[model samples]
Target: MNHLKALLIKFVMIAVVLIVVLTLIFDVPFMDSIWTSLVLTVLAYILGDFLLFRLAANRSSQNVRNMIATGGDIIIAFLTIWYMQVALVDANGSIALGSFIAAVIIGAGEWFFHKYLDGNVVSKNTRTTADLEADYKK
Candidate 1:
C-alpha cells in the first residue's frame, strides 16, 4: 500500500513537471511528452525511488540517505529524458539542455518526495517508540 501510494504520487508529480517542461520549454510534442513522462516516471520510481532508497537504508543518517537517493533520482531522470528525446522526439538537436533542465526540475520535486517517503514509509521500521524517545532526549 505504501509503495503504491508513493508510486502514484511520483507518477503524478513527474508527469506534470515533465509535461510542462518538455512541451513548453523544449517544444516536444504534447502526446509524445506525456508518453515519455509516463515511462520515465515508472522507471524512475523503480530504479531511483525504490532501489536507491533501499540501498540508502544502510546509511546511518536519514539526511545522507535522502541526499544519495536524490542524486540517483537526478541521474535516472536525466538519462530517461535524454533517451526519450533521442528515441521518441527523433530530433537531430542536442538533448543536453532539455535533459538537464528537466532533470533539475524533477530532482527538486524528488527531494521533497523522498523526504515524504522517509517520514511516512521508509523510516517506519527504523523509528521504533524507543528510538523516538531516545531522539527526544537529545
Candidate 2:
C-alpha cells in the first residue's frame, strides 16, 4: 500500500510534467485526458517497480541495478501510453521512437549522474531516505 501511494504520487507528478510539456510544445490542453493517463501511468509504474526492482533486485553489478531502475521508467512510460490509448482512449497521437529512446537515455543518464554526485551511493540498503533526512538533521 505504501508503494501504491508512492506510485500514485509519481503518476500525478509525471502527469503534471508531461501535461505542461505538451501544452508548451503543441499548445494542447492536455488536461482533457489527464485522469486516465495518470491512473494508467501509476499502474505501469508499480508494475515496473515490482518486476525491475523487487524481482530483479540483489546483484553484484551496479550497472545491472541501474539498468533495472531505468528499464522500470521506460516500461512505465510505454505502458502508460499504450494502455491509455488502447483501453481508455480513442485518439492516435504518436511519439517518434528515436526521440522517445533518446529521452529515456537522457533520463537514465541524469538519474545516474545525480546518484553519482550523492557519493555514488545507489544502494538503498546502504543508505535510505530516512537515513539522509536524519543525517541532514542539523
Candidate 3:
C-alpha cells in the first residue's frame, strides 16, 4: 500500500514536470513527453531510489544519501529524456537544454522523495544483521 502510494506520487510529479518542460518549454509533443516521463519515473524509482537506498545502507547522512539518489536521478533523467527528444523531436539544440531542465526539476523532487522514503518506507523495510540478531535474542 505504501509502495503504491509512493509510486503514484512519483508518477504524478514526474509527469507534471516532464509535461511542463517538454511540452510548454521545449515544445515537444504531449504524448511523447508523457511516455518519456512514465519511463523515466519507473526507471529512476527502481534504479536510482530503491537500489541506491539499499546500497547506501543508512551509512551516510540523509543529505548525503539524498544527494547520491538525486545524482542518479539526474543522470537517468538526462540520458532518457535526451534520447527521447532526439528520436521523437529530432531536436539537436533543445535536447541538451530540455534534458538539463528536466533533470534539475526531477532531482529536486527526488531529494524530497528520498527523505520521505528514508523516514517512512526504507527504515521500516530494512534491518541490519545486528538488528536481526538482537530481535532473535529478544
Candidate 4:
C-alpha cells in the first residue's frame, strides 16, 4: 500500500510536469503556462524535501529525525507558498498559484505513504525509528 502511494504521488507529479511542459510549448505566458510554474514549484519542493530527508537521516536520535521531518514538511508548505507570491511565477502567476496548491494537495498523501513505510519502531538510534519519525512529522 505504501509503495503504491509513493508510486501514485510520483505519477501525479510527473503528469503535472508533463502538462506544464506541453503548455509551455505553445508560448503561454509564465502565469498562463503550467510548465514554468510547475517547474519552479517542483524545484522548491524537491529542495525542501531533500533537506528534510537529509536532516532526518543525519540526526543524532530517532526522535529528532521525526521532529526534523515534520518541521521540514511544514517548511515546504510555507516556502512553496512564498515561492508563488514572489512573482517568480510565470503565466499571469496563476500557474504558480496552482503549483502551491498542488504541493499541499499531495503532501498529506506522501507523508502518509512515508509513515506507513516506517511504522515499526526498532530503536532510538536505528534507521527504522528515525525514518518512522520523519514520516510522522511530515
Candidate 5:
C-alpha cells in the first residue's frame, strides 16, 4: 500500500512535467505524453527508486544517495522521453529540447521525492533478498 502510494505520487509528478513540456510546449499529442509518462514512471521507480536508490543508500550519506538516485532518474527520464518521441511519435527537431527540459524538471522533483521516500517511505537500512535468504539458510 505504501509502495502503491509512492508509485502514484511519482507518476503524477512525471506526468505533469511531461505534459507541460511535451504537450503544451512542444505540441506533442496528449496521449503520447501520457504514454511516455507511464513508461518513464514505472522504469524510474523500479530502477532509480527501488534498486539504485536503496543500494546506494546503504553505502553513502543521505545527500550522496539522493544525488546518485536523482542522477539516475534524470538519465532514465531523458532516454525514455527521447526514445518515445523519436520512435513512436516521430516528433520534430524540438523533441530533444523538450525531452531535455522535461527530464531536468523530473530530476528536480525526484530529489525532493527521494527525501520524502527516505523520511516517510523507504528505509535507509533495508536488507537485500539475497542477504535474507542467506541468513535463513544459516
Candidate 6:
C-alpha cells in the first residue's frame, strides 16, 4: 500500500513533466507522452529509486545518494524516451536531443523527489538512526 502510493505520486510527477516536455515542447503526441511516462515511471522507480537509491543511501551521504539515483533516472529516462520516440512517438525532431533534454529535466526533479521518498515513502527500517543523523547534519 505504501509502495503503491509512492508509485502513484511518482507516476504523476513524471507524467506531468513528460507531457509538458515531450508533448508541449517536442510536439510528441499526448498518448505517446503518457505511454512514455508510464514506462519511464516504472523503470525509474525500480532501478533508480528502489535499487540504486536504497543501496546508495546505506553507504553514502544524502547528496551522494541523490546524485547516484538522479543519474540513474536520467539514463533510464533517456533510453526509454529515445526508444519510444522511434517506436511510438512520431515527433519531428532529433530524438536524441529531445530525449536528453527531457532526461535532464527528470533528473533535476528526481533529486527533490528522493528527499520526499526518504521522509515519507521509504520504510523506516531501511533507514538507520545514524543515517538520519548524518543526513540531518548535512
**Maximum-lDDT candidate:** 5
TM-score of each: 0.83, 0.52, 0.85, 0.38, 0.88, 0.84
RMSD of 3: 3.8
Q: Write the per-residue lDDT of candidate 5 for residues 1-138, one digit (tens) a residue.
A: 878999999999999999899999999999999999999999999999989887774433679888999999999999999999997787788899999999999999999999888887876467745446656889
> Which tens-of-lDDT digit does each residue in 1-138 have in candidate 6?
878988898889888888888788878888998998898889999999988898775544778888888998999999998998889955456767889988998889899989888888887677645477778999
Return the clash pairs for model 6, or none: none
Q: Which of 1 and 3 is ahead in lDDT?
A: 3
Comparison by lDDT, 4 against 6, better one: 6
Candidate 5 at residue 116, lDDT? 87
Clashes of each: 0, 0, 0, 11, 0, 0
lDDT of 6 at 120: 85
Which regions of candidate 3 are displaced past 4 Å? 57-60, 128-138
| Candidate structures ordered by lDDT, highest first | 5, 6, 3, 1, 2, 4
In angstroms, give how far residue 16 of model 5 lies from its true place: 0.6
| RMSD of each predicted structure | 5.0, 9.1, 3.8, 8.5, 3.9, 4.5
Candidate 3 global CA lDDT score: 0.81
Residue ranges of candidate 4 with Cα displaced over 4 Å: 1-9, 13-51, 57-90, 119-138
Q: List candidate 2 stretches off by more than 4 Å.
A: 1-5, 59-62, 82-138
Cα misplacement distance, residue 117 of candidate 6 (Å): 0.9
Candidate 6 Cα lDDT to native? 0.84
Tens digits of per-residue lDDT for model 4 on 20-111?
Answer: 54244323343433433354346533553434544456344534555555456545644544454344434354545555554454454445
TM-score of model 3 relative to the true fold?
0.85
- Residue 94 in model 1: lDDT: 54
Output the better candidate (1/6) by TM-score: 6
lDDT scores of the candidates, listed in order: 0.79, 0.48, 0.81, 0.46, 0.89, 0.84
Better of 3 and 5 by TM-score: 5
Query: Which of the predicted structures, 5 or 6, would earn the higher TM-score when compared with the native?
Result: 5
